[model samples]
Target chain A: MTTLTETRVDEMSFTSPKPKRRIPWGSIVSAILLSLGAVVMIAPFMWIIQAAFGETARAFVLPPRWLPANPSLENFESVFEQVPYGMFMFNSVKIAVIVTLGQLITCSTAAYAFARLEFRGKNVLFMLLISALMIPGQVTLVPLFIVMRQLGLYNTHAALILPALINPFGVFLLRQFFMTIPKDLEDAARVDGANVFTIYWRIILPLSGPILTTLAILTFVTMWNSYFLPLIMINDPELQVLTVGLTLLRGQYGAGALGPIAAALAMAIVPVLVVFLMLQKYIIKSIVSTGIKG
Target chain B: MSEQIMTVRSLKRREAMAAYAFILPTLLGFLVFVVGPMLASFALSLFDWNLLTPPEYVGLANWEKLFSDARVGGIYVNTLRLSLMVVFSNMTFGLLFAILLDSKLPVLIRNFFRISYFFPYVVSAVAVSLIWTFLFNRDLGPLNYYLGLLGVDSRINWLNSSQWSPLAIVIADVWKNVGFYILVFLGGMQAISRDFYEAAEVDGANTWQKFRNITLPLLSPTILFLLVISIIGALQIFEQPQILTSGGPGDATRTIVLYIYEQGFKFFDMGYAATLAISLFAIILVLTIIQFRLSRRWVFYQ
Candidate 1:
């Protein structure tokens, strides 16, 4: 009877074969639609790249060429010749670097205080900082412009850099990250007689490599792409950043100079694209976590 | 033991002082830049003073003008229209893309799609707008060229016509910003537990029913957040219209911020501009509060 039962079980197992693999039609459709959407998303940049490298006259022609027939560097040369494109690029880099560094220092310190240390009015101070986020920059634009001019900062990079150095959002982001860090390490340092600044610099900042990098990239990109503030504050062509400078270039040349304009745009976009591609994981994560625009 | 206690107390005091020192820069900046300027702008609204002239007390003159200003009325309408279009398209497309991305696909292809979608967000608005101008060009732009091939014969004056210019601004703004909404929504959707979907499947729920019952409620908070921010951002749009149309075809796309800039800088009506700025601030504040209050009805915390 035992031999018969064993044979029956074996037969049952053998009779029931594995299921056949079915084609994932849903997934296939999704992939195709997604791929098409992705092409549409990047199509503008593709057009710009084609125009930037292609002949100037071909930019407006019917049945626009997706690929440059004879690529050349003349449009790029024209961008520099037409305006101080290099100066604008340099100004953008300088201002972005200064503002990013300044925000990291100021925001990190403030965040440490808010997260780790206790003091009088701590909650009130934090509330004040957060409230400022709701106040649109336009509310301050008129007075800030007046202040900048009064302080001899008009038409200067300092006007652009000074106001952005201490972002409330940055402070809030850093504070949240700092609070997530375990207190045991900090307590150990305190037992060893480490001072507040010492602990912040050595313990908190070093452990905060990821958040700090995120904030740095966010601030850098914001400053690099800032247009309105620079447009209002700086009247001098020499002081203008890339965004304002590109507009000036367009204003001077109008639609007739599409090639040079495209070249300048390519120049402006390439550095940002390179930075973005390299650190995209962190950038996307930061945007998701903070809800801050890049 | 008393001496040791005193030493600890002193150490705590020192720590507090150190904390104060750490926050001083931000505190000072806040006071100088944000707080001071806000107060100054409010005060400046009461006076008429261009940069080159002595101040004259306006005494609600600008306020009265703002109410009666016909152009201001039209400009506000245009601004609202543009914002509505942009917010609708952005949210719809953003949610669609996020849902599409949530489907079964290789991780590699997912990243590629995400990066491609988000690439334009990082680029300068001015540069992108400049390129858009070319694309919107009447006769030679690829947009019209493609349309012609698809059986349309006439060229659309996208930047020149009042009708088309606002639509063009909406397109450019949505193209640049929808990526952000997509990522945020994707993040929110991914955070939903898979167990719920599996349970729904066990109950014989179809894909749409599962999504409608499980995903929508869970993602409500994210949707609310995006709606509030997108409305605020859309309302204050400056670059796309300023670069594309320059509020052209007669104040068609002149946003509140653009109008403020023009009043303050172009015409140098400083007092009027301050009043406009205050109105914008009030509008945003009210909208944000209303959104939060309304979110209580629909937004699910979990």
Candidate 2:
């Protein structure tokens, strides 16, 4: 009877489940499905890289190998020879840097004022900024082109840089980020006789590194990859950024010169990709923090 | 006390001045870049001007031409069709993928998918279009090769057919943007309270019911916001169609932005281009306002 009771206790007691041996069916299904989707998402990137380096032409009879049989630097060399590739890269870097720096100054200052300072017509001004944010860039395209031409900035990098520096989006984003900073920090700084600009410069800014870095990277990427503005503004091949140059090159070369163009495209994407990878934390963090208001 | 009051008043004056100074850079840019250009665009719409010739005032003639033009209807239809396809599909797929990613997956696998999807958003549209061209090319495109292997007709022209061209462009555009919408929805999903789900589970609610009641209701604001953003952005889409089809074999993918661009640059009809721009701007504004008004019925606020 005691042995029977012991056996009943053994049957009743729970055994620790073997997590490793038991297949994680939920995770397995998700992985397989998402992996399929990931191929769809990432295949184009691999296509460009292969096109840049590989000579595997498309064929209906057989699928070309995924990896290159004979990868070489010839396509890149050809790209360099055809366009002012180096100059285009320089112009892109220059415009992106200038615009990023300009946005930082303008956005931060305007955001600080909007966030911390009390002024006449503050709400109205903020409302105006919001309205302007809704105005499509195309609506302003022709007039901005006219204005830039009038100011003799057409076909120049400044044409691309100046019109863009007034990003209401940046101001709006920074203002939201700035609003989250504790008012006490500024008040404390003020007690030490810090002025508004001084406090914004010394205290608010240092505390806003994540958002600011995020904005800077975004601005840089936007400017780097900008097509519409550059396409309209700069016609001179010498002043062309990567987007304008690549389009012009492709139009001229068509399908025959895929290799060089692919190389150029690959080169064009790398910097933004690198920055995105390195500082990805800030990208997600900034959006998560500010998306509610947005 | 009198001296202190005097100093306080002076300090208030100084503060206002500092505020204005702080805002000056943005204000100047706003006037010179944003407001001034908008005013100029409106003014330009009233006149006939080409870069070669001086501007001539035509009052509402350009406006009349735009509204009454036969091409505008077809163009609008194409644009609306393309945009709605992109907006709806991107939202559905983005939300779907984000939900999947939010499931019980390994952190590494989840992060990989997130980056892989968002990769396109950062790259240039022109570059993206070039890749699409190669993939869609009839002679050597992998799309055809893969389709043939799947026992389908292999010699399809993806970007040329009127029926398929716009859809092709839409696919590319949606692929380009879905990652961004995923980011937005994922953020919204993360912000929701898990307590509601727990309570529902305790009350014997099934997964579907819980999602329909709790997740759907809670995510409405983000949905509405994404809708507005997508509509506005899709309305302005130029580069994809421009790069892919140059507005098509025969205006199959001709959008309003392309129309504006063609009139302004290719035809050098700045006046009409400006008019078309104003019309588009009006359409966008009205649509956005309508969306905002419509949001009240469904969009939940905390």
Candidate 3:
């Protein structure tokens, strides 16, 4: 009755047709428009890759080279030689990994409590947590900067890592996932005299694999690409992450160095794209589920 | 019975303690990072304070300056105009793409195009900005390169010209973000039930009629959600303008966020910056509330 692919799009909510009919002209028109849209959407990226491989900064010369005339690895080579690109990558990976782990643990626990465990003021507290979503991070930047400065956290990775570990959306996402699980299992665990922590660690966490992994990916990508916070907090060149470091290459290296900068840019973009490709389904599901419900 | 009651009370208290333990990290984080800063920001906005020196009690002086500042008005208008353009194009095209991809086309063909479209979203903003910066180059940029092929004689340095800088920012930002919006729209499209379409088909409803009567009504909620978010996100446009344009070309690309950044970081006018931030925050808050109120009328949950 079911297959893996079928389960993948459980929300498709459409049934297969019995026989083929004439090509829907209306659908065809829409498809052409969509394909055109896809082209427009994707062209910039294609152009970037093309330009990155060009032998010179003259890649942008009129009758703009759509395809690289003499593609070379010179840019890639120079990217490594000129800047501490590797160090920036390491910092990004380090911050992303630690922040992802922290958020997974913290948000899971909080979500479990809100979804299953009832306490005095639970509704009010959960509201407080979700309400944070409405407020933009820009609103917090100035004050957070002051607080971080007071705590001697300016120009430090802790400023970036710590704040990221407590995102409200993760908690909300995990809670929604938790609510969908059957309650009978929790009751059984309670009857066995398992404490809340034990029940959560063993029963709840095991069942929440899909949502947890989803949260992890979202957290990792978001933290990895975070620019503004890193921009404001870590001013020291040494403390800069991938985005900040890459930005410096543009300003300092000048237009002549476009090849190397483009190479580095390609390198910076590749990892996230790789991760996205691997987990496209989960990412799509996570966003769709949360956004539609909200 | 009395003994059992006492045991149950003890159990409830123990459960409460566990709940607190589980929630402590996130709660404390909220208080420290979110609530604390919000209060501090409000206070900072009232006083003429730079980090290096003690703050003077300026009262509403910063707020007053924000209202009187010509630069503030200019930034607001530019940001608003750019936001509207982004929101319009993103939603209009995103929904259309979702509907097309949801057709009976080969799954591989559909998915390949979808992936191709989304390829740009995963790239870093800095990277996208760099790529576009090259394209917007006056002499060597491919935009002019292509325009040259079209028989246009004069070449415009898109980002260097006041009239074009803001438009350039919009084009760059939309290119980077359109994929994410497409995915959002596609997700919503897939979630619609087949029964409605089937019913419409049986009733001799053509594609247009079916879409107008069934799909459009059902998809309104998703559209509304996207619209509100787009409006909010568009209003806060920063990175593209900051990186690509540097809010330049005579400040034509200066958004509200950029203005705040210039004041706070570059000029060290934290007080004035806070005032700008508060103004920005209030506008966003009002817009969000208005959207939320309006949703009840048109955002069909079912």
Candidate 4:
């Protein structure tokens, strides 16, 4: 009789009203912590934005203003007057565009060959190329400088463009992506009498839009932001890119005036930030997948 | 049969030729830029040359100077110390944020934090460093002002003082870079099987226990990958310190790469710079090998 009564009680409990959902304190706390961290992550950019538009004198005041009390474009005008900011931007764009397009063509062709075509010593060649990734650019910095000078390419944009035209990492990434593509598409194209180049140019390139965009964005950003090579290779102010130009601006005005320095930095950073925000999902996914940038 | 075989051979030959043509550009670049320079760097290390004069054979003098150079030794030590601090802070915060994001938060909120954290990384280091210089200003900067509000009266000489300069570099570097680690770590954590967690729960394991056993053991491979890359990158750090402190208030933040640049460009000592580059390569090579060897003990492949 006692066992039967216990069974009835258990059944009643099963059919009883569901208990109220407990508050998720753990999740709430995690969210709060993450939000705080996010602020710290973006605080510097905020500081730069406000300082860029504020009066130079007000920029350094203690308990800094969160927003410019009276925003002005005077700092940007000073930046232009102080440096050839326009030339710097143009040079940066030209080099970055050329490198990005050049890499797309070169990397895709090589990746196609490695992924689809059979050639002698292919494995050995691929391995040799991949090994270049391990050698730091510093190792070649001295010798490459000499080579550039000897070739009379020093102090020219070509010095930056030529070496960056072919990245081993890009080849590796595209090759991996190419291999995942179904072989049937290429086989079909071949059956229709398409040549190797035709197949790669038409079918493979079309299928590779996403990865190509990823690579283009990466190459563009890298080339745009590249400082070390340009700093060493090009000394002429006329040929200077934004990164090296900003340093010069800093040297002149960084101490007493935060406004002009901040303005130049804002100009350099805004384009990249806009691109990043627009395509963040792809950027994040690509970084996670490639895991090679470092 | 003979005709058919001939056609087959001709077709194979054509394919091979096409393949060679396809790879020719990259192959040429690889030879001239990568292979040629690597050999030339070592050869250049054996000679002395400034841009103004003809090269002279110095045998192993540059290498000998490397061992005796007091500044080089301290710079290496500084590089290693800064690298350790940056790597530790980056990895810790990276894993912490990844775990936090892994919680059952709304997707919209998670995305917000993700984008905010990663914003700094995509910007130019030069630009990022410039922004940091303002914030790290000793007297009127916001950091010190905020600290003052918290009851600290003394201003921290973030960029000017030797004691705080390295820490400033680490902070700026981690702020820009920790997001990369977070994304990588989050990817690694998501790649882990949910079945492991479910099984642990059935076994009556607590949250800490589950993380300690299932999450960590499974996350070991990712940990090792990030570790090796972070160390390598940290060792080669240049832009932040170069822009922030210019290697400092007396070489307090001088890194190997910066030193190499100064020697090669500023001082026009190409041979010594080449020697330093070679030493850095060897150090990185050995350290990477050691890490991999040591990883065998703790890295769980699954």
On lDDT, the candidate that comes out on top is 4
How do the residues B1-302 of candidate 1 rate in per-residue lDDT, one tens digit apiece? Answer: 99999998998899899999999999998998999889988898999988899889979998999999999989999899999999999999999989999887789988999999888888888887898999899978988888888898659999999879988998888788888988899999999999999999999999899889999999999999888888898888888888898988899888989999999999998888999999999999999999999998888876
Which has the higher lDDT value, candidate number 3 or candidate number 4? 4
Task: Summarize candidate 2's per-residue lDDT along A1-294 as a digit string, tens digits.
Answer: 999999877766656444467777767776787788889988877767777786523211247446666777777877887889888989988999999999999899999899888888888988898789778888999998999999999888889888778878888988998999899988888899999889998999999997888788777767887888888898888889888888877866776566778788888877768877886767655543444221
Question: Total clashes, candidate 3?
Answer: 1
Candidate 3 per-residue lDDT over residues A128-198, each given as its tens digit: 98988877788778778888999999999999988887989899989988999898998998899889999
Q: When only chain A is evaluated, what TM-score does every model earn? A: 0.90, 0.84, 0.84, 0.91
Per-residue lDDT tens digits for candidate 2, residues B130-187, read 7787777776778888888999988788788887888888888877777888888888
Q: Model 3 in CAPRI terms: which quality?
A: acceptable
Per-prediction TM-score of chain B? 0.96, 0.96, 0.93, 0.98
Which segments of candidate 3 are over 4 A away from where they belong? A1-35, A292-294, B151-154, B202-204
Which residue pairs in candidate 4 have backbone atoms (N, alpha carbon, C) closer than 3 angstroms, thus clashing? Answer: none
RMSD per candidate (Å) reads 3.0, 4.1, 5.7, 3.1
| A24-106: candidate 4 lDDT, tens digit per residue | 88888887889889989888888888889988667777678779988998899998998889999999999999999999999
Ranking by TM-score: 4, 1, 2, 3
Off by over 4 Å in 2: A1-28, A55-62, A287-294
